[model samples]
Target: MVGRADDAVWRPYEDGGSLGWMGTQGGTIARDEDFGGLARLTYELDDSRSFHALSCSVTGWLLYHRFFDNAAAASAAFEEMKPALEALLTQLPEGGPSVPGNARLGGPILAAFTVRYG
Candidate 1:
């Protein structure tokens, strides 16, 4: 569901609560039409990497990813934050805003990851 920087819909996460992870400055919500109504809630970090929780209306599962400068870093960060991410995942609501099946929510995170690693 990721979009190019020029085309992606980006909005800051306004909810006023700590994300329960370190180095997180804030987060953004991204939406796109090509990802089966996937919404991505992505958190910005002090480091070059970022974290995300990808959700859709059809499933309660939250896909987690750590977008880092490199695969090595991503892997390491994923490991370091696995427990916290899992806990966060449990707390996220199921079935976000209703959108078309082709819509995607995590456009910015997906776009950034693709550009940096793909």
Candidate 2:
């Protein structure tokens, strides 16, 4: 898991990306793709933990969305994961993340959210 700025020595990795390479020891932190010192961390975590996470940086906040598979599998995962995810994020007193109910596209999308840590 990525910690605060003073937690590790961060360095650039990919294009517009920064990573605090820990070499599997633990805790590899990454910043956003802006190439600025204040970039948000991009973490590829929780691969073996039953779900895959897709993340993006928007307006300085990192957003995460999850899924298991398509069709029936996605439905199943959403049902099982929704409560845990909601409980974890909505615990924030800042009213948690809100769905704007606005998007450019039509059709379906798995729930998307941003986790703002102090």
Candidate 3:
């Protein structure tokens, strides 16, 4: 199930556990877990070197994760994708913010920490 987010590329795991990067986030890697068979994982391209994960419910509009990177590279990536981001924002619902304002964009660093801490 390969898909594109602007210029980045992603795909689902062989077991259908998680959707991950194909060649965009450095290389091929899959993040797997029991997604209750109802998870929708979306990768938003932040730049040429980075991206964010927007994990949501397949049956509802509930957003589970909004991972972001705060590195200089990520900042530059965000700037590069600002216009697209704005366009995305315009497509949001009218009532309120669809995503949390301070969700952490899990990346390599955060993944390492998660493995080590939990």
Q: Model 2: per-residue lDDT, tens digit, 63-89?
A: 444433233553444344434333332
lDDT of 2: 0.32
Local accuracy by lDDT, each model: 0.35, 0.32, 0.35
The residue-level lDDT of candidate 1 at 86 comes to 33
C-alpha positional error of residue 59 in candidate 2 after TM-score superposition, expressed in Å: 13
Best by lDDT: 3
Per-residue lDDT of model 3, residues 8-80, tens digit only: 3223434653344552334223343223233334444444455544332222223333445534543343343
Query: By TM-score, how accurate is candidate 1?
Result: 0.24
Model 3, residue 91: C-alpha shift (Å): 26
In model 3, the runs with Cα more than 4 Å from the true position are 1-29, 32-34, 40-48, 61-65, 70-118
Q: lDDT tens string, model 1, 5-109?
A: 343332322332424443232333331112223233443333333443322221333343444444455444434443333333333333432444322543443
Q: Residue 107 in candidate 2 has what lDDT?
A: 11
Residue 44's lDDT within candidate 1 is 38
**Model 2 alpha-carbon drift over 4 Å, by segment:** 1-62, 67-69, 93-118
Question: What TM-score, computed on C-alpha atoms, does each candidate reach?
Answer: 0.24, 0.24, 0.25
Cand. 3 TM to true fold: 0.25
Residue 64 Cα positional deviation in candidate 3, in Å, after optimal superposition: 6.0
